[model samples]
Target: MNKLRLRVQILFTILTNGYVYGFLKGKIYQGPLKYTCVPGLNCYSCPGAAFSCPIGALQALLNREGFHVPFAVLGFFFLFGSLLGRFVCGWLCPFGLVQDLLHKIPLFRKLKRLPLHHILKFGKYAVLFFLVFIGSVFLFGGFAKIPAFCKYLCPSGTLFGALPLLTANPLLRSQTGGLFGWKLGILVLILFLSIIVYRPFCQYLCPLGAIYGLFNRFSLLQIHWDEDLCTSCAACENACPLSLTVQEISRSPECIRCGKCVKACPVSCLHFTAKSNGYSTKHQTCVPPGTNTV
Candidate 1:
């Protein structure tokens, strides 16, 4: 397989099995642990999670019975987003990485590209609004709260997070009702669609990705383009899984910072840059150090 396929498979294996190292005799390893913010919408409830899930923490913050903003959690979210943009989604997220692998299946190909891409991209924001504003605010009635995103949507939480939790805890499973069934149905639908469509959850329903995407343009870590060297070859545009035009927005909200465009650019005109205090500088050469570029 090619490098992209290899990377996707390696990521999948790491996400699924690498966490095994942290578990011992059916319990989490108790050594001094450190947590970092992961970019996509994985759940903190997962037994293997090394870091807190921003969406889960966001809901908990909003659901706090009193007047308290979970500053630490929100701050971490912003800090991670500002530093990495959607790099987590591109390279780190288990779910996003899964979609990347699924989309590579040659049997299921996109019928058309670009025509409806812009319109469909709005769904993720809608999900964010509904969960944060309508569900969290309008419907919050004391501790009797519903994690709207996870309850009604969020397949990642359902499949990777909740299902495992339920399987491991019989008490949690016995308490399940119609709502749980509905969410499970939603998860099943999403999983089925993922086999055919390219990351339907990330594209349409990931609130965390939507939030991080807002900072994509101004994020400290970003894609830099040299307009002088670009031929407008459309190769980058075609390579983008999110269907973004690199020229229009190299750091667009839809751009996951996946580096597909960077690799696809025939002239090697695109690269990553680190920005500080409104100034940008190249951080890494297009090619790895000591590697010869063709």
Candidate 2:
């Protein structure tokens, strides 16, 4: 599954970022297809990006002068969120692939738990609410729409958009200032942190991940836990990249559905399924660690 997911990630990344001409020439793809938003948090400002980012599109809609409902962008969120949840984060996001690859590097000791991990996880939600949702709507600079998250904080924009655009366009390069340096510093910090933390951005910063995560339990596709599997060993929880107790969470919001826990399960119980919460009991409760009561 890991290998298959890796292939899919690579293929999807290439498909979404297919415009080699744009990359070479440092121009955003202005084709008709660019209007379509992909499920992943890809930067549309990326010269090679063939599709718009969902987050970027959402911000654009909200950033407009009038406060009309962003039905189109909201529909995009609901459609994808209901269908796949944060599975897009695990298998589709270009930045996700970058972090996955970085975490695979053996240079540093990977740390899953931090002193304030539980508190830190809420950061993404704050980003979604404050920067993307609220900031985009109200914090405009004159008539221009300000995508607050992308313009200020998105590492994807800095890495895939601004960097390449500046590199190829001398005009853009000449206009670089302190804001560029700040964003570049953020990118560098995330890249460095990715070496030791698995998906630090998605876990704690990405507004898109926060939005998609809300649909995890409600999504059509989910990690199903078989209650009849006999022992509740907590092995799957140990294997979880996000340190979520897979057996108990019943499709945890933070779960990207990476299937690492499924692979590591001693009892072959957890698997991907479209069926909703098929466990015998209606109430999904956490079986204590080191217990076989489940």
Candidate 3:
């Protein structure tokens, strides 16, 4: 499944940023496709980017002078989120691919889990509401729009957009200041931390992931856990990249639908459901960790 995911990631990365050769010539792709938003967080300013970021587009629309619903952006999320949910995060996001690769780097002392991890997971929601939504709307009454999270916190933007642009254009490098240093520091920290943590940004910072996560409960594609799996060894939970247990597997917002748990199941009872399918009740019953099923 991971290999399949890697392939998909590569394909999407290429498709979304297909103008790679242009970057070498110090030119960004300003084609008509730039108006369209990709479900993932690929930056619009990326020299090779063929699509705009949905989060960035939505925030920009929200920050406009006149009130107008961003139907295109909202509809894009609604369609994708309702169909696959954060599976987009698992399979499409270039930044997620970067983190996955970084985490694969062998480390003797890996930071598999951290203290207050569950609590900190809620930070993505805070970022969604506070930084992406409120900050964009409130911070700029005179300007066009302010992508607070992208400008301030998105390591993906720093790595893909800022660094590449600055490197390609020497003039921009000469104009660097304290803000550039701060963003560079953040990118370095995130890169360093990705070697140890699974996906620190997605779990704690990405507003787009948080929005997609809300749809996981009712997404058409879902992870089905068979109650007839026999032994409740908690193996699936251990295998889950996002740390979801079998009981929460059905409709977990945190689940990326990566199929790691499905692959890890000893009884071969876990599987993906194209539609909502009822599971066998006689084989077993497992409660999610840190919660009572009742």
Best by the lDDT measure: 2
Q: Write the per-residue lDDT of candidate 2 for residues 102-188, one digit (tens) a residue.
A: 989998788985559889989999999888887888754664558889878999999999999999999999999999999999999
The local lDDT score (0 to 100) that residue 158 gets in candidate 1 is 72
lDDT of 2: 0.85
Range of the 10 consecutive residues with the lowest summed lDDT in candidate 2: 278-287
lDDT of 3 by residue, 1-294 (tens): 778879999999999988976588656887899888999999888888988989889878887786678788899999999998998998899999999999999974677555799798899999888788777877644644587887778888888888888988888779999988888999898887888888888877788899999999888877777675548988888898767778887587777787888888889778877663443332223444566444
lDDT of 1: 0.69
Give stretches of model 3 more than 4 Å off.
140-145, 276-294
Clashing pairs in 1: none
> Which wins on lDDT, candidate 2 or candidate 3?
2
TM-score of 2: 0.91
Q: Judging by lDDT, tell me the better candidate of 1 and 2.
A: 2
Off by over 4 Å in 1: 1-37, 111-116, 140-144, 276-280, 283-294
Report every candidate's CA lDDT.
0.69, 0.85, 0.82
Q: Please, what's the RMSD in Å of model 3? A: 5.6
